[model samples]
Target: MENRRGYSVYQIALHWLIAVFVLFQLFFGESMTTVVDAVENGQPVSTTDQALGSAHYWAGLAILALVLLRLVLRLASGATASANRGPRWMQLAAHALHGLFYMLLLATPVAGLLAFYVGDPWGDIHSLAKPALIVLIAAHALAALYHQFWLRDGTLKRMLSPAG
Candidate 1:
């Protein structure tokens, strides 16, 4: 792997952009579900519901695109994260968690798209993915805090600052 000194400006920008979109989705995602339920029940949908659902739909697409771009950049640039002094299992767990993050990131949006555009099992999957993602994100933040405070490592700093 071709390791760089630190994350590139584009990488950092994408990371933050994706984070914002993901948070938006997490908070406002219920709007989309509400709209879906209303449509299914043959109830009239309010303009606000329509608007929020539209926003959620577009945000999901944005996340999907941003994540794909980020993944490509990560692969093409081969910029590895900061190396920490940790046990082998800890490192493996981190890697596994990241891989799961990517998979869920990609799959969740696809499920949403299918649920909205198509319909059924996908909606259930999408619903399940939200809580799973929230858990993963919480764990990720906690791990970063652990590295920053407990380990006194530069892991969080590497993400915070584009330049080393």
Candidate 2:
């Protein structure tokens, strides 16, 4: 088997960290939305739900910081080159997908922050950011699935294993 280029330690760390944050944001953000809906419909918000909402809010802020750091690390390290063994169209698609990933990743959290500031009344700051995050997450997930299943080009593996 051929050895692939592994991602730098910093890149690996950032990737995993962001993955965790994104996953957490997805779950917790949805939970907060449910809580808000329940309250609006004259249902009581459970203590556990309230706590989760608060946690999500604080976590979102932390995610913002980590994202900024990741962006800086990305700029300093430069981006990985696309795997060279694909068809021209596949290669182009991979590049476009990656570009979209970065754009959505950056935009999602920023939009969430903006939504928070714009008076979303969930009282849980993170819940307010869900609308934007949902769009980004959907985009990110679809792109990943496309590369992994449709393209079968190992673009996902590149990040999962190491950079080449």
Candidate 3:
């Protein structure tokens, strides 16, 4: 699809794509570890098991790549005007939540890479942060829905589509 004048389609797609992929990882990352456990426990590991085991690392890397792109695009495009008419404190909280999201998104996967590839202990840090990330994600999604429904504002719609 062609890029819109204000909200670039690339940005929109990346945002949602990364979101769904990350959410998938959050929910199902443990299942990926089962492949390795099966082998460790003397259970036969199928080719499919190995492939699925690799997905956790691959998906983390994918999230890193997409988030990097999203950051760049967000900076390049400049964002649309705030549709938030909420209090100043709410706005500050929103910015802080967003900043935390970006930081964790980058740090977690990089830590995973370090642990897997370099035998670093940072992998534990990423593991520890998973629950935190889930909480943040839930808050973010809830806030978006609140803006869309409770506020009856276009803020969430703006993220959904640039034309909003």
- How many clashing pairs does model 1 include? 0
Candidate 1 lDDT tens digits, 63-154? 99999999999999885755655787988898899899899999999999899888898899899987898999999999989988888877
Per TM-score, the best of the predicted structures is 1
Model 2: lowest-lDDT 10 consecutive positions: 119-128
The clash numbers for all candidates, in the given order, read 0, 5, 0
Give me the displacement of residue 54 in model 1, in angstroms: 0.6
Assess every candidate by TM-score. 0.94, 0.66, 0.83
For model 2, residues 26-122, the per-residue Cα lDDT tens digits are 7767666666578668898888888887776677777778778877876776666655655788667656765665666666666656655553532
C-alpha RMSD by candidate, in order: 1.3, 5.4, 4.0
lDDT comparing candidate 2 with the true structure: 0.67
TM-score of 2: 0.66
Q: Write the per-residue lDDT of candidate 3 for residues 1-164, one digit (tens) a residue.
A: 22333456787788889888788778767655565457558887777657765888788899999999988887776754566577889887988998899998898888877766655366456677679988998899998898879888777777776563
Of 1 and 2, the candidate ahead on TM-score is 1
Q: Which has the better lDDT: candidate 1, or candidate 3? A: 1
Lowest lDDT sum, 10 consecutive residues, model 1, at 79-88
Once fitted onto the true fold, the runs of candidate 1 whose alpha carbons sit more than 4 angstroms away are none
